[model samples]
Target: MRVLMRQSAFALILSGLATPGALAAGSHLVSSQKLDWETATKLASEAVRICAAQGYSVTAAVVDPSGHQQAVVKGDTVPLQSLSVSYRKAYTAFSYGQAFDKNTTSELINAKLAGPENGALNTIPEVLFVPGGVTLRKADHRVIGGLGVSGAPGGDKDEACAKDAVAELQGEFQ
Candidate 1:
């Protein structure tokens, strides 16, 4: 009799016929904007151009909120390793931005490094706590994606290129 009752309850739950009290309470609904392919490609191209203007052959990557690469652009003479670095930077930005609820990855890095959590963030896979990564946010402060640049002489220089790319598309984010 008990086994039959358990089976019936499982069936009811599977069919979405369970009562409110029988189900777990409290659920969250999340909504976020996605960075389309067109915008991602444009952003990556602009970032590469920005670095090139400074005489740096760099690679740029754009990633959506889920840390998936949307587009990547490699400048001439850039090292092959830059492609992976750029993707990791972009993924780190998106992951950290979402985790901290911040609009910028640089700020998150700074805060995390200065606080007691210094060096702890590096334990996470594919999370580079370096500069050169920035978050893309909408007008309402919702993060939509991230942009990263690699292959420059310094991480700061790469970060500058990523920032310029985001600034260029700031008007379109609305």
Candidate 2:
């Protein structure tokens, strides 16, 4: 009877009918990759440099997958508001998986795809439905974080700086 019960339980576990830890003496292992501080800072710095080269004083921010600020680089002449805007843009990109391609998050939001009525995404706090934000993907195409650049006179210019920064560090992504 005991042998039959054990076999049944084992089968249940194998079939995923039982809870994961029901028959396990140890914990399950989980692994995920995240952007390191060094890489985040490098990205921010590169974005700022790119914007400066284009004669745009901007603030660049990098955020993790959890929408936490990883690094922020503010140009000497950038306004204080740019800091918040840059952070919001980064958070939005990280939350929405938006890339800095031809059509940015801002454009889509403005086009009503993610308008205020659509889950009120535009009304979300700390989310800037604007361009200048780009998702950071690993070589395996896993999104690890996001970068945002603000105060570049236009969203397109800011997006360009952010895109250039990510392109420059393409090889460094794991």
Models 1 onward score TM values of 0.76, 0.76
Which numbered prediction scores highest in TM-score against the true structure? 1
Clashing pairs in 2: none
Clashing residue pairs, backbone N/CA/C < 3 A, model 1: none
- Candidate 1, residue 116: the lDDT equals 51
Tens digit of per-residue lDDT, candidate 1, span 128-158: 8778888777786666778889999988999
Look at candidate 2 and tell me the lDDT of residue 100.
Answer: 30
Candidate 2 lDDT, tens digit per residue, 1-174?
979967876655532235446556443432345678999999999999999998999999998866789999999999889999999888877766633332345555666555455577667898777889887776655667788899999988998999989999978886
lDDT of 1: 0.78
| lDDT for predicted candidate 2 compared with the true structure | 0.78
